[model samples]
Target: MSSSETRPDQPVITGATRLYAIVGDPIAQAKSPAVYNALLAAAGRNAVLVPWLLSTADFDAGLRGLLRAGNVDGLVFTYPHKQAALPFADVVHSRARQVGATNALRRRLDGRWEADMFDGVGLVRALEDVGTSPGGRTIWLVGAGGAGGAIAFALAEAGASQIHLTDVEADKATGIAVSVAKAFPGVIVSLAPPSLETVSILINATPVGLSDADGLPVALDDALPASLTVVDIVPREATRLLDLARASGCRTVGGAAMVAGQAAAVLDYFGETAA
Candidate 1:
């Protein structure tokens, strides 16, 4: 619709100015810049990922400008903007199409935007990195919002035998559960908070650990089974819930794994694999 491009206040020749960025309404808290900068340097690329703040009405315009810039290879999309970027892409990866959202956008050789959704793939990949496989494993997932829904879908696709999803919103949880059951007919699906039983994996996709949100998404009375692999998708440096899970002798994965995995996928969308 409308676009704004970033350029030096004055034109200058430089070899260190290749560009990448993460787009969102509130970019202040994003860890992408820190992570991507390190990754780029590790790869010996003259590029960095920065934060871009744009209003909902301006997302399209802001993205157009970013893609048109010669220096920016791609941009990672974040909350409130991921679903909106879909129509602008010339190509939509299958995951994005299935999820009805795009979390990464890259500029093609033809100069058109192509997009993909990587949250679920990232989660599954991160789990595998920690020696846990969703296949044949029973997983209990909390929160059925966008990230949670995507995670549920990924687990189903990864051959999870059973999945139980819970959200503050019953309808949302029910909707995702139905979708999971329909998508993977053999997988058992249910609604409600997870019971501390034989579930091999526990995933918390809610923002409870963030913003000082009181109460963990999983119930306090719940004792995490030592055999269970736990993952929390909150990107804070440290989280009490994750600490508790570890202190209880459960194998735990932090939010950073999900963030790195997602960033890897986003980098892939830019046609560059992680080093």
Candidate 2:
């Protein structure tokens, strides 16, 4: 579909009606609809950012339908479905496979769905926005789950000298550390708790700040050096951890920056220039 075209009233779906969706469970919390829809509108695109709230049990059927839908321009995979969406892609980006997740899907010229993960790249872009490069920095990443794993790998690729991964499940954290170390053997890797010392950049990948979640992702009571750069992947306007970081005189980056970067990247995949 052309960017300027509008859908007909009570009309049939066709190849001309281009579509896009962000798949997740309990998708009501997602800001993708607001973020991407704004970008699409600014770019004068006919696309819409619809939410596909699919359960794990419904993943296969939902994905098949998306692939078969001729108007589906692309998709943004989120939350629990990041890993689940990997196998459906005809071409998986190397970074996505190594991180074991994907957040973007593009329709190839040959009519095959190609998958790519933008979380890590977006995280690095967010970090750079705060005036720090992951390269040559000692980093500590909390939460080795899907988002954490992607962020860790992205940090390694961006030149982090050493990365210490930590999670409630030590194995999950350490397992990712192993994969990252193998991917970049020159970088030091290990599992450990969050510490202000020796960490130039700290990332929180857990959902600790989300509504109805437990305490801060990290212990905020402890003193953090002013040299530390804190990045939290929580989209709230101002998270408690971010507040603490501000109070401690540390440079801070928000989840919204990551959201912005991802939205810009996804629009690029949709063959539209970001506004």
Candidate 3:
């Protein structure tokens, strides 16, 4: 047998293969194609996930085009598309509804799109990997977009004691805080400026730290305590935030850990192996 056929993770596409796509405006940077394709292959699925560079203006109609494809099984969304993708789904799952966004969309056997957000679950898993848990931990979370909202809800569900939310747009922060607080009444969720005091964990959920020119999402006045854990969802392993968090004497979790944590959960939701 050929190496591609023998290797479980190597995809061997055929006419019977199922199709999937990860859509975003700048789809080139998306990691889902590589991540999801490998997961699908390892699950013994004859499927392939590809990147779709759909423009923001074209998102709604463009997505309709994708779903119309009979062979397309599902889609993964990133950036501007996550929030926009929610309305396209026939069923908006509780996870997506609570987060105000959807990151994964699967077509039902009945031919309807079902969607949910997994970014927060990914963060929760990432936190747990380093012996940290959101439960009973006070967190200062920066960012209130789709992913930000998702993270807030996930943290709340994981039993975070308190989640202090902030965003450049104050209302966005308030939206997530309100939704999460309402959904998880036991978890204290509120909008506030990022602060180090009393918070055991700090997370940068925004894109601010993704670029070299971007300023640090939160300005720490001094070194953090050993009790505090810092996480930045920017995919770069060497983001200045991570470096600063390490230099400032605290635990640091990078974006890859979050991706690794979410991969299996995402596949489970996508349901190739389980299906």
Instruction: Find the candidate with the highest TM-score and give its number.
Output: 3
lDDT of 3 by residue, 97-154 (tens): 8887888898887888899888998999989989998899999999899888999889
Off by over 4 Å in 2: 1-16, 220-222, 272-275
**Residue 243 in candidate 3 has what lDDT?**
81
Q: In order, how many clashes per candidate? A: 1, 2, 0
| TM-score of each model, in listed order | 0.83, 0.88, 0.91
Q: Tens digits of per-residue lDDT for model 2 on 120-238? A: 88899989988999989999888887789989998999999989898988888878899999999989997866467788988889877777445678665556788999888877667
Q: Is candidate 1 or candidate 3 better by lDDT?
A: 3
Write the residue-wise lDDT of candidate 1 on 102-178 in tens digits. 77877777766777778888899999998998999989999876678788889999999989888888887887788
Model 3 scores a TM of: 0.91
* Ranking according to TM-score, highest score first: 3, 2, 1
Model 2 has an lDDT value of: 0.82
